[model samples]
Target: MRRTSARSRISRALAVATAVAAVAGLTAYQGVAAEPAARTLAAGSPEGYGAGTTGGAGGPTVTVTSADAFIDAAASDGPLQIQVNGTIQLDDMEKVTSNKTIVGTGTRGRITGGGLNVSKASNVIIQNLTFSGSDDDAINVQYSTRVWIDHNDISDAYDGACDVKRASDGVTVSWNHFHDQDKNALLGHSDDNGSEDRGKLHVSYHHNWFDATTQRNPRVRFGNPVHVYNNYYYNNSGYGVASTEEAGVLVEGNYFENVKDPYHLGEADSGPGSLVARNNQLVNSGSGQTGGSVSTPSYSYRLDPAANVKSIVTSGSGVGHV
Candidate 1:
């Protein structure tokens, strides 16, 4: 979020001055202070930070109001944190570069009528933002790795709200709210693009609130083992999670209320995949099919109870309050 106004700048300056003065006083009195604690990703979240991800670590924040500037800030060399204050409308696709953390300031921060392209980027984290009316995908990631998308509200996109494809690996999508959308999310691009997609696209999708989304609460493709867990689904018109085109998915501990299709192994014409469904709660909904089993993920995550998913997700999912 940008401090563009004079009042905002003055307020920030005064706040910084007060903080510096207080810190100096405390240091002088105590003679020394404790070392800062090391930062970690949110607990039980399995986003890879082993060798390829450091999203905006120890970098200055660059606040902007336009989509072009946001992309420019992300495209810079070093890790950077980019904040968008108000809604930014775009006429073209904005490409987010590598090693960036893009966060919205508050409830009013949003991206409208545009799309974010996270192609070939690594260590990117996008959170606390609202995306709507996008001419294309609200957020598209291809050939990327170690990305985390959390606490966002995405709706009414022209294409899929969030699509990850082209061998993207080690990603986590958590605590997002999806409503009034169609083709919500997609894992792989196509069935024919199998070679590039093989043995890639490992992701964790958890704690999301999907309300009335039409379909593709992530339709998956080949060589992807997506873990879908502890999500809340309300009155969904289409399927909840589809594991198609040889894709493997583990659907577990989800709450489905009045949804038509809670989970399925494959699409209408797509090749059959594998899914393991367990501990799901269904109320006035269909418990979808399970064909085979998928291999377990290489990471660990704590799963919330399916019976309490509605309460847990409703109280914490989406932007502005994170």
Candidate 2:
């Protein structure tokens, strides 16, 4: 993927924010179900406090209208707060951003077509937005660092719900609700640019809930080492987590229910570097049992000892679990 300069990335973010604002009339718009107290949030109170600086906190609130305005605002020198009211559609959202924060009216603040595409930007935060019914991913990042996505509900995405792709580094995806998403909940990497033939790396996904009716949770691909922990998932068509062709992964303490397939670690590089699974709880609720593939690590690279799990409660395991 082509890398965007810092200036251009910020510019694109602001531009989009501006256009979205105008279409939604969020500048003075009030939520139809907004509570009276929620309208006037106290300035210094935690409820309605402004977003901060690029690295700090405290920034101006801008509404999204046109894509250009959104890009420009997100690239501003300081932190930015984006309030999404209506649908923000994009012809192409390959824009990168730095040090901006976006919020929406829960899941109702719809950004339908344009994904919050970020690559190689740093210190960006997105919170409280619902990315709904998009033909593409709700939000995607490539080569970005220090980005946080919190409490945003993304679903019905044509591809992955959120992809930390192409070696994007230092991203945290947490507390978001997801359902009916295809592909993975979070797809990430760990190592550096291995070969130009492959892709860049660096990303982490944690604490997100996935209610997949058709697909699975996530796959650590292209040696992208990611940390998966404490998340809940159900009715996935695939594994809870798998290292498809990548390595340096850690899966710990996650809860799974009615997952059609539990875990699979194949097609990864021969070395132990490509896969690691431990301390994850996978239970099939229906009559179908949990089905997966597991092998002892090669003695050369077996670092962490895999734990034998005792079935907790009358858990299902690919055996009539369905």
Candidate 3:
């Protein structure tokens, strides 16, 4: 059941804050520190296909508060960690190059009006940012590899909050709060691009809070073993995860509340795919459709119990919470 009381929510938030403060020498997201830490994947590192993603680690950290400065830093050459300190209003979809870590500072970092384009790049990280009013996708990854997107709050984008397509591989989208948006995350752009996307587009979607989002809590295609696990879904108007165009998805250990259509094998104009659902907890939600055999994820990671997913995700997802 959903914890609707304000007192309960405050207690949970306070408990989470206390736990974060106990971790020593980690980063701002974990505890208070004199200097910001370098870019690193939190805790157990990225699981599933993005297991080895390490973005902009061992690089000089540069803080950017203006749009021009952020854009310049994002497109600069070599490995760099760009720390966003305030709202950066962008004019268009800004291009980000390889070996970059773009992270928000505390809860003040915000990206508005435009979005990020990770095109043909590799080893990039985007974390702890608030993305809204995007003219395009809040984060678009195309032809990229080994990218990790974590701990972001995304909403109000004209296009998808995050869209990964065009043969991107080894990507992880985790611990994000996606709400107040129509289209959410998507994988594999087109039905005709199977030639380029047949063996690619492998992604992991885990531990995210899909709160009242309409649809596409990723509508996927051509990604085998797309791992969707330990996520919390609440009051989504449209369906949750869609595995279309012969993709294979594993929906496991999730907590779904008031989502009528949770997971399915196909979407509009797309043929049936393969899906496996296991150990999911549904409250006032339908038992999602499933069929065919899905390849097991090769990476090893611990799974949080489905009963605790609401508290776990709500406490840890979005900016400033890491």
* Model 1 misplaced stretches (Cα beyond 4 Å): 1-53
**Weakest 10 consecutive residues of candidate 3 by summed lDDT:** 26-35
Q: What's each prediction's TM-score?
A: 0.84, 0.64, 0.87
Query: Per-residue CA lDDT of candidate 1, range 20-86, in tens?
Result: 5324321111111111112222222334222245576544454566554554555556556666778
Clashing pairs in 1: none
Determine which window of 10 residues in candidate 1 has minimal summed lDDT: 27-36
The clash count for each model shown is 0, 60, 0
- Model 2 Cα RMSD, Å? 10.6
Worst 10 residues of 2 by lDDT: 41-50
Per-residue lDDT of model 3, residues 1-322, tens digit only: 2212322332333334334543433222211121223434333466767777767765555566667667766776676667788899998999999988888888988999999999999999899899999988999999999999999999999999999999999999999999999999999999999999998888999999999999999999999989999999999999999999989999999999999999998899999899999999999999999999999887887899999999999999988886
* Whole-model Cα lDDT of every candidate shown, in order: 0.76, 0.51, 0.84
Q: What is the lDDT of candidate 1?
A: 0.76
Residue 120 local lDDT, model 3: 95
lDDT of 2 by residue, 1-322 (tens): 1123433544544444445543433223211111111121111211101112232144445555444445445555655565555556555453546766665543445566657787667767766666766667778877766776666667777777787766565555655677767665545443343452143344444456666645535666553345555566666765566665544455655666777665555434422235455566657632322223333221121112112222321232211121
Provide the lDDT at 15 for model 3.
Answer: 38
lDDT, model 3, position 13: 31
- Which candidate gets the maximum TM-score versus the true structure? 3
